[model samples]
Target: MTALAGLLVLVSLAALLWQRQHTLLTYFQQEEYDNTRFFTAWQNVRLFDLRATATIVVALVVIAAGAPFVGVKLALAAALAGIMLIERRYRFKKPLAMTERAKRLLYLSFALTLVLALLTVVHPLWAIVALQLAPVTLVLANMALKPLQTRVNEGYTDQAKAKLARLDPVRIGITGSFGKTTVKHMLAEILEASGSVFYSPGSINTVLGHTRHIRQRLQWSHKYFIAEMGAYGIGSIKRLCDFIHPTYGIVTAIGDAHTERFGSIEAIAQAKSELAEEACLAGGTVVVNIDVMQYEPFQRLKKIYDLRMITVGAEGSDVVVDAQETDGASWRISLHSKLGLIPDVTYDLPLLGAHNVTNSALAVTLSLVIDPEIADQIPYFTKTIAQVPHRLQVLDTPGSALILDDAYNSNEQGFMSAVASMDKLAKKRGGRRILVTPGIAELGLEHDRVHARLGEFCSDRCDTVYVINPSRIPSFAETIDADKVTVVEVPSFAAARAAIAKDLKQKDVVLYENDLPDLLEEKRLL
Candidate 1:
């Protein structure tokens, strides 16, 4: 019985750890292993999660009451097994590649579990109680492994830096709360005409991600390298800047995209401004979004780095977007620079949303600054700029449903812009506009207010709104009128897709807004 209990505890703990490894590591990485945030996320149990609570309580009680050792162990093992089974059934599993740091942490966690299990020889109660410390064990392991992980990361980063120094391409770093990827792709398209351009692919914006891209994909022949820099806290972008040493930079727009992790808008701006500051320090020109110039940080940046700064926006800026009008799945934009008013440049962009015009304007300004010879090619490149995979990409469906896919890293501003774009498309196609969303998540303290405002916005814009998650329904209910908008509640994405297919017809436009991964509670079927 003692050996059997030990085996059960070991197997159950292994299974649980395997399941939670990715989420645990992600939080650890994002929060920088801050105990406060780690513990908060660790213990963020759902209110009225009676099943989990009851299981924990009963296991403790049994161990405390000196129940048969095997029985108590069996109970704990059964509880863990139940949890693992439920997670496997309901959770969407993505292919998570464990980093060297993650692997070290995992090994440490397993060793801790084994050490605790060995205490079963003295008291089986020790093994039973060890299950409760799963989260704590991972935290302890991370704390232990951090120094070694840092050394390994630094070693690889140094090699990447050496490679970068040898090649010395014209590096342009782009950072902001949003639109960095779009701007990166836009700049890449324009600059390709000037020379061979290598931009960081997709959302590979972190320090390690950038290092890997540089070491593996960066080529000697590439004349321009655009690095998309992202940050979660202060100095994060500065760290990236220290490595790549960009010759030019663009601060797209300052917003509340990651304001939750940043704690405040000021902190977010400070973090994002690191890119421009570093670029200016390196004697490189920095392009500032004129709209965000109203912010104090950008104002401060301008005061200190005025010579290296160029502003772009709708009006009253160095690079001006005189007009932007959409004509059935394409955008017509007119741009002017300090040099002079360039002819009105119109392009059939695969992208949607007026916000993209701002991104495009920044890209165009930077391209002209880099190579004035590409001035005439601006219209051609803008017309041929391919659609970014998920950001406002249009999908071809076998059915007549026109699907506008904007289901990645959603923010309040982006969501509103998508809604406006959807409204326009529906009007042109003479179809009913439908919005299918689980609503946005990860706004932290601003979650309720943001969703409430989103609901209010959807009430007026969408003909039919299908809300997937029930947790968001209350916030939406606060502002949305059920009678005014045909609101349907769904338990899963499958169900939502089914409903759309049943009602979809030719010219029907369905805008899939912010999609949450299954790891988030908002994606769960209630």
Candidate 2:
């Protein structure tokens, strides 16, 4: 009976580990396989969850009813709890894909779990303790595999570099706190009018991700390769620049998008300037938004790399944005070249938010800089620019409600711009303005200040606001004028959708400002 109870405890422990591995891997992937971040996120959440606690109680009650011995009862209960956990479904906003890297991490994590389960033979309490320490096992596994992961990354990066050298396409690097992905999409489309352009699709901008794309998709016939460079730390963009060696770099406006990771605006600025610095050192022409030029590090880098610098979107800039006006349907922007290389032009753009106007202008300015001859085709291409998906994208609903899907927006500036657009369109159509948001992420110390400002702005523009994970940004609801506006606090986006279904009326405008991943939206326990 003692031996049988020990065996049952091992079975339950194995089941629990299997279930926990899935969730750990999902967040691990979301954190870009960074063990430090994964561990930090793990620590912030509780160690025990409601389901696990309930399952244990129910299992113990049932086992105690059938088993006479205390040891047998505990063992039977653990076996039953394991059975319950094995069939558990973990919900994630971004489901875990069993990619090659994910598979490797999963395998290594399970192997570590198996070793911990081996201790269950000596005492059943080891299994219970291992349940709480599961997150630590994953962190340890990731840390142990770092050397091997580095080697694998190096191999792929080397292959990508070789392929890039042989093809020798015009490489253009785009980097900023926000709008870099949108600009990459816009430039890729505009440049495609003239030649075969190969831009990194979506936000796949990391070293390994870009390497995979280059290895798999890059062709000899491709004339241009647009690289959207994203940074996790100060040297992150520099690492990518070292890999691609961009001939043209565009620095969009720097902001507090990832200020938490980098710690300060100056660090973010210094990190972004790495692209400009690298591109300039390579004798590459760089187009920078005038806002980025304010940073001291950027100014110093610009002074060093001033030979091939072109400023845009401000007075005395090489590519000047004179005016930006939007009707309810689209935007018409007037821009002129101060350097007189490219012709002055007015862009009729079909996109939302004033930031997009700036994004489009930056894309146009860089496109012309690459080839002044394509200036004639620029206006038509600008007119035909399709709205980037999920970045303030407008969708028509079956009812009179207009859906503005800005689910990918994360910066305060972008959020405010979206709110402004929602207000304008709602008033133009004589409709109620609605907003759904999880607020912004990685704001660090500026989180409260930013959300308070957004709340005040939304109080005027929005009639109905659905604040998801309201506890994450309590200041948002606190600042809103509850008398005039209706603020609904819901746990998940699905809950908000259910509420909206009941109250949505004709001629209503809904803006999903920013959607967070499951890691930020919910508190998960081991």
Best by TM-score: 2
Q: lDDT, candidate 1, residue 357?
A: 81
- How does candidate 2 fare on TM-score? 0.94
Tens digit per residue, CA lDDT, model 2, 1-526: 7666656656666776777787778887888877778777776555343455455455556655885555654655565565556536657788889987777778888878778778866754455556666777777878888898899989989999999999999999999999999999999988987799997788988888899999999999899999999999989999999899997999988999888888999999999999998888888888889888889987887687664777887777767786556676677887787558467777788887888888988888888878877878887898888888999999986766899999999999999999999999999889899999999999998899989999998898899899998989999989999997999999988899999989887798999988898778878644
lDDT of 1 by residue, 1-526 (tens): 8788868865775565455444455555545557667666554432112343456578768778988878887877788778766755543434335766667876787677667756655764564445556567778897787788789889989989999999999999999888989899999998988999997788889888888888998999999999999996898998889888998999998877776788978888888888888898888888878977877878898999875788888667877775446565667776676655333344445467888888888888788777877878888888888888778888866657789888884788889999888988888888999988877766767788888998888888889988877665469755777777888888656688898988788888898886765444332211
- TM-score for each predicted model, relative to the true structure: 0.87, 0.94
Q: In lDDT terms, which candidate is top?
A: 2
- CA shift of 353, model 2, Å: 1.0
Worst 10 residues of 1 by lDDT: 44-53
CA lDDT, candidate 1, residue 454? 88
